[model samples]
Target: MTNPTLALTLGDVAGIGPEITAKALLAHPELREIARPVVIGDADAMRRGMRATGFDTDALVVIEDPREARNDPDTVELVQTGPSLADVPIGELSAAAGDGAYRFVVEACSLVRAGRADAIVTAPLNKAAMHAGGHDFAGHTELLAHEFGVKDYSLVLSAGDLYVFHLTTHVSLRRAIEDVTVERTTQVLNLAHGLARALGRPEERIAVAGLNPHAGENRLFGDEDADVLTPAIEAARERGIPVDGPIPADALFPAAMRRGRWNLLVACYHDQGHAPFKSVYGDDGVNITVGLPAVRVSVDHGTAFDIAGTGQANEASMVLSCVRAAELAPGWGAVVDALS
Candidate 1:
């Protein structure tokens, strides 16, 4: 079989997306062995990133089609997407940046849907910039969900042995609370369990974090944990998933990460997972969205507007994302089927 081709989307033009992606494609020399990577972004933006990141422009091979790409580490294959971003300001948010990032994602998605690419490994996009560009969706997850026409997806982040799936991400705290319904909770747990199996870990030890302090202290803090989270965990167990919790948020993650007690941990909200995950894993992390028609692994970091054009951005996370994408692509169909 041919190597799985990955459509790598360059995120917002104003951030380190292009710069880091350019650097990452070069940093991992074994990437070409794992999969063929075709960059999906503006040619000019990529050139700017190459210059800023100190990669020779000759490393980039501009291609109009995925079939034109060759599996060669010596060249960075690119399929330019979006409007001309040659004059767009770097290190600052702009509508052009937002629209440009969205264009790259759409093109990559189209390629994968058409069977031209096997998977997508995205760099970060700014939600504000995307909104300003008028293509408003919460973030990549929501946008991908909409494009794929499925609501049964979940955003999962992995670092070393720990995996976190958010129950409510990118919403107001009030809305986040309202979103922690038994149905959503059960669905997310199911998604998380499916994700573990998809990643080749059949021994899935899943943990659910409580929404309230001390897990509502048995009704002292709040009732969401007992009222919503508990039933979901019970239902998942009934479904034959190895699951446990509504454990106190404070005690749960530390023990899991340090003690290696669980393979998957479901968080109540965005920061509940992201905050501690970033703190411990930092640049060695990857974000995976499970239950999509195609496989997607992405850098867990955001658009670094501060270090956009400085050639100072680290590509470690992007490298990890690509590595994970390559590892998962071959088995992704089984995952989509399991989640679907």
Candidate 2:
């Protein structure tokens, strides 16, 4: 099989997306060997970022086809998605930057749908700027699901060795609690299993975290653990899925991540999973959208508006995003086979 073409969408130009992306491409030596990396953003912005981040390259190779990308150490191929943004200032939000970011994602999706690219890795985008520019989406996960018409989807975050999927994301705390149901939990568990399989762990085990403190303290606080969670676990087990839970959130993380335990954790809400995952992985985590028709992974962090254009943002998360994208591609087995 040919090398999988991984298309990267520069998040928000005004933020650190371009800078960190260029840095990741330059620092990772093995990445250029496994998959043909292609950037779907403004060429000029990428060049500016390369210069700003002090990443020296041989030349800017433009390509019309993903198969034409040269898998050389000094060569980085780019497919221009939007017009030149040479005049757009850094560190300030503008409609042009928002439009450019949106166009990059749409173009990447087109490439993936057309079979030109195997998977997509995205940088961070500012929600406020995107809304102001008429994009009107909460985040990348929602946008991708809408574009592909995928109904069963979950946001899975990988921090170090810990993988977590939330029952609800990008909503208020009260709304997230209210949204918890047996059906939703089961759907998330199934998605988690699929994601684990894609990551080369087909028989991965999953543990579900409870909603309330002490797992509702035996229904003294709330009945969510017994009513919603216990039934979901039982239903999944009936289907032959290896799942265990309604475990207390406090004890779940340590037990799952201890040594040889479960491969994934399904959190009842957002913070219950994220807080522990981020604590271990720091900026090395990647947020992947599971159950989509196409492969899409993103940096777990958001646009650092305060430090925009400062060249201080770390690219570890973006680098991990690329690695995860390569792993999910259909031709990923070739890359892994060659490495092994």
Candidate 2 residue lDDT tens string, 152-265: 888888765567888998788899989999889988887776665656675778988889998898899899999999998999889877887888888888777655366588
Name the weakest run of 10 consecutive residues (lDDT summed) in model 1: 194-203
What is the C-alpha RMSD, rounded to one decimal, of candidate 1?
A: 1.3
lDDT of 1 at 158: 91
lDDT of each: 0.87, 0.79
lDDT of 2: 0.79
Model 1 misplaced regions, further than 4 Å: 199-203
